[model samples]
Target: MEFTPVTHVLFDMDGLILNTENLYTVAFQNIVSKYGKDYTFELKLKLMGSQTHETANTIVKELDLPMTPEEFIIESKKQFELLFPDTEVLPGAKRLIEHLHNKNFPIGLATSSSEESYHLKIDKHHQALFSLFPYKTFGSSDPNVKRGKPYPDIFLVAANKFPENPKPEQCLVFEDAVNGVKAAKAAGMQVVMVPDQRLDKRMTTDATLVLNSLEDFKPEIFGLPPFDD
Candidate 1:
């Protein structure tokens, strides 16, 4: 099937590019479980793609935990680092980013993670991957903190950084969760949902395209010729 050409592409960092979402889930569950509260996988799915603070608050309320959002965030981050000392990039993620870089496509990262957390999760090698892109926008850098995922501020910030010609509508966003997809759509950009195994069923609808994995993604699908076979 023919696909619409994209002038720019925006990527979500955590789940879309890195396989850190499950690690996060484990971290949250571990911490919450100690308080005699369970952080189920379904709950993790519900909170995926949200800002750390927002998610922490939700967990606090859901599990009746005795911690403030700030406290929970600090504890969760510590646990996440312990649980996932070595971050793993998703399948085909590095290749896809390199391919886009080689083609000089304007690339950007729009995620609900804080800049510090983003860097911690991405580290040096992944930061090198980011250097290949001309522009980037992180959730912490968003001017409107009140509006994060499911609000389009982050994606809009990234899209606006591109040259004035193509506009947001001409850009494409690759998201791995419902909130990210909503944010991308709210920005008026075409969205491709690369749903993770842990994603909820509700997250699957109304996406411009849905695929099981990035392994199936071909450059030709984005109106670029496939570089391999």
Candidate 2:
């Protein structure tokens, strides 16, 4: 299969860069269990890559919980604040990011997280790794991004932030969620997906390329600089 050459790369932060999916699962479970609801992987697949308020709304509606989305957000934020600081960089995430940065490739972050939650996840742990990104779009917080993933707004917003303002076809998105892959494709960009193993194989069909992990990626195939190590 031939891969199109790409000029800039945009990344999703949660499962792609940080091993925080489990932490989110823990947090979500903690909240939903109060209502005697089970937070299942199927629900997680549907919710991944959604903005903060969107996620709370989905969970409230999906589980028929006894709280408003606002109340759910308040509870979720309490859990996130306590849990997110323990976030760890995923395997191969730092290596690939540093490789792209050292090669002078323009890379940006586009996360569904609000700025407050984003900092809670990365500030104390992976700040330096994330600092390599010159541009970052916090979908839940950026008024310019009116919609989140599955809408393409965040990826489109991120690509526009590049100094040269590349066309959608010139940007490559790296994501770990089906919603993100759909968003990237809808934005007319190619996406490399490194999804969780539990994700249904059928859900991965929209990705331009799918990998087991970022460590398995070869930048040269996408016309980027090859890794020295």
Candidate 3:
């Protein structure tokens, strides 16, 4: 029940740290719409936290779209970049990062996004926001070659980065997607779900803590004061 006991924190980038899920949704819909298929919000939610090719294949099969997975990925990435040229960190993200960094806790970013796309979304400004974190794990960087989200590969990779003797139970994962929660749970880590626009009832049940936003998180939850100053 207590969260402050966590030693390391792992974060999911897109919907969790950066508020870009909507942009992804818009891009997906725009691309699919050109082929006469409707990519509803409900459908987009199903694709959340999935790998680019996986999501594209899902859409292709579901809508019987004509494009190949590779084409879908290429076009979708282009559209997303154009639509979201600027990125913004979610509320409380900077504060939480600073708080954890001040306490010398190791931080990791575990995202299903490709390294190139991830870098594009997180430009120079966004990098400064997360400059304190010492570790990162990307879907493109992992070698296990397993499915993303709803699967534990990404989280497992990040968790393994801790000192060789670290216990899995001591790590905490911050996620914003249902699949991300599932991944963390499968990885045997305590998870906090900070819901963005896509969170639903089913996703909340799997989380150790389901919060409306990171704004409500405080260091005291980990037995520390609100701020050092």
Best by TM-score: 2
Candidate 1 stretches greater than 4 Å from native = 198-202
Question: What is the lDDT, from 0 to 100, of the residue 120 in candidate 3?
Answer: 82
Query: RMSD for each model, in Å, please?
Result: 2.0, 0.7, 2.0
Descending-TM-score candidate ranking = 2, 3, 1
User: How much lDDT does each candidate structure score?
Assistant: 0.79, 0.93, 0.79
Candidate 1 lDDT, 1-229, residue by residue in tens: 4567877888888888888888887788888888888888778767877877779889999999998988998898798667554788888788888988887777887778887777777674476876786766767546654576888888877777777656777888988888888888888888888997756566688588888888778677777547664
TM-score of 3: 0.91
- TM-scores across all candidates? 0.91, 0.98, 0.91
Q: Looking at model 3, how many pairs of residues clash? A: 1
Error of 1 at 186 (Å): 1.7
Judging by lDDT against the true structure, name the best candidate.
Answer: 2
